[model samples]
Target: MSDTTQAPAATGSTPASGRPAPRFPLPALIVMACTTFIGIVTETMPAGLLPQIAGGLRVSDGSAGQLVSAYAVGAVLGAIPAVMLTRGARRKPLLCLGLLGFLLANTATALAPDLPVALAVRFVAGAFSGLLWGMLAGYAIRITAPERAGRALAIAMTGIPLALAAGTPLGTWLGTTVGWRWAFAGTALFTAAILAGALIVVPDAPGQHAHTRIPLRKVLRIPGLATILAVVFGWLLAHNLLYTYIAPYLRQEHLDLTPDVALVIFGVAAIGGVWITGTLVDRMLRRLTLASLGLFIVAGVILLAAHGSTPLAILAIILWGLAFGGSATQLQTAAGAATGEHADAAISMVTTAFNLAIFAAGAVGAIIVDGVGAKSLPAVMTILAAVALIGVGFGRRAAFRTGR
Candidate 1:
């Protein structure tokens, strides 16, 4: 975390000793992107298949929701250890191992005959997902030039929102048409593809610092890192509170919409948001963060007002998706910039905070739904969105003072 320990500068076409540090090749970037895509698909596919899974397992819909919550819990717990244990390991092998774990876990889930087994398998899948995402962010940064780091990170991260846009709808369709098991099986296949791609594409560039000597305390003490973590946690909590309930809420309101339709809309809007924001991120990350937060506030308000009207509700959701997608890249970029040399730790902390928010939001949303019904969701989201705006304001002020 010390400026003195900054990564060795890239000399003219080579390191100082004349050996070339590996360049960020397109194939390697593709491999890392696939890894992120697989992890996200595995984590989010269950959201679209929850009803089918619940029916198959002989449980209420709310009970099946626990499967999603359980996965998040696993992610929150797994992130830090995954980074610490694998620190300085080669990127290709780490990615391969992570995808292999995901493949096995999803395969187990696909074959499991009972809800308990399915939940446990999902937990395992989430652990690997957390590891993959945390490592991928740092790996992507190392492969790209400093000026283009934000863009590179966004490209790698496009997997997650893309999964939501395409993978979720595909999983939902497969589940409804064939069976939920097929959805899991398909995820396993995607995992396999990601593993194969990673093994072929990513180069092994070990950090110059002694792998065993990461200064944890120094990393934690970095300026603005802790504040960014707090903002990310709040932002995620607000988003997931509504996200976890979106499909169910629509169904309960008798909107005459299928899970596939909902997912398709959500995914499309999310993908569009991610694509547009990725282009703008390098030029205006801070401004985009503020704008995205403002959009989130508007989306939450619209969600509150349009809950009963099907067309209006759907429109609101698309706006929500756009806001959510844009916010993700901004948060990750902000966290990475704050951590500098310890980007891996920064990413891990953000992943951990993000998942913890998911679990908390899901649990809290369920309680709200059960107690006060869907009508309360908007009020909850509004409060969280307001807090996130406040956090962003504070962040901007702090950055201005520090000339960051």
Candidate 2:
């Protein structure tokens, strides 16, 4: 928890505050991102092996689904407390310890005897994940050149899309090739390697103003933060509503691109989106945001209008990845931009909203899909994307007016 490493001075750059930031080591940044990648891959690994797990443990499909949801639940409920409780801890050591716990959790899941035991193991793993995500942005920024914070953050955040893109297919192959338990065991091994990397490469990062507690009131009082939260919440809700049911929707539409293939296309597009936005965001925050949301709107409309068309469906999937792909970069960058020095709490709040939005959208999307129709989900997404666009406008204006 102590500052085990000294902050290194920024090279060739001074921030708007006229202070030099520590120049983060690249390996450290990479290890940080890898930790997240492993955590999420482990968290979502069960989805690819659900039937096997259910059959192996003698549980129903619905109960198996709880294993996946448990992690999201833990993430949503744990973000704030995790961030706050570890507020003063050294970033590297804390992240290392968290990843270690992650290793244990996955090991536990791999060896769990019953559905109830696996669910509990996953929830604990999810809490560790929540802590890692909530702090990652601030940690990235704190150790990077002040002017290049956005890039540093972008690099660190690449884990989310990467895990989403790779986790299922890889886990499926592993689980299918061997057994369901092997997937968790394999992830535990991967996590252990990343943990070693973290210990060796990552420098300790203590908060700049470690003595001052970032009060929730102060974060809430920040101009346009509410709007940022709104955009993140609404945008995620809109995206997940349809995303959770994408395969069924595709079946209903009779698209040729199988769900798995479509996911690959989406994941690749998202990676492209992240790198592109990371480069442009610091320079054109508001414009790029509008553009990002616009892509989602276009994607939704495409799916709604061209449900049965293969080409358009392909386009829709690509667009979905592009817009939603760079989301972490945009949202976390917005948090850093809005909160300035007090970004940890801001990041935590945004992260909590982000986590909760996943479940909310899933539940709501299920209702919409189950009742009206599958295609209706896209219609709802388009509406939500529009709301998010409006929120971006108001949010930027408010932040400017208040000089945030």
Candidate that would win on TM-score: 2
How does each model score on lDDT?
A: 0.75, 0.81
Name every residue pair that clashes in candidate 1. 165-267
Candidate 1 residues lying further than 4 Å off, grouped into runs, are 1-24, 50-65, 113-117, 211-217, 248-260, 307-311, 397-404
Clashing pairs in 2: none
> Among all windows of ten consecutive residues in candidate 2, which has the lowest summed lDDT?
1-10
Kindly list the per-residue Cα lDDT of model 1 for residues 1-404, writing each as its tens digit: 11111344443356556766555566777677677777777777777788899998999888887888778778888888888777778776787788899989989988988989888888887788778878887788787766556667777777777777777777888998999988889888978887777776677666425644566677677777777888888888888887778766776666767656776687778777877776766666666777787888887787677756878778877887788876667787787777666778778888888888877886799899999886677678878888887777787533211222
Q: By lDDT, who's the top model here? A: 2
**Per-model TM-score versus the true fold:** 0.85, 0.92
lDDT of 2 by residue, 255-336 (tens): 7878788888898898899888777665566677789999999999999889589999889889999998878778887777
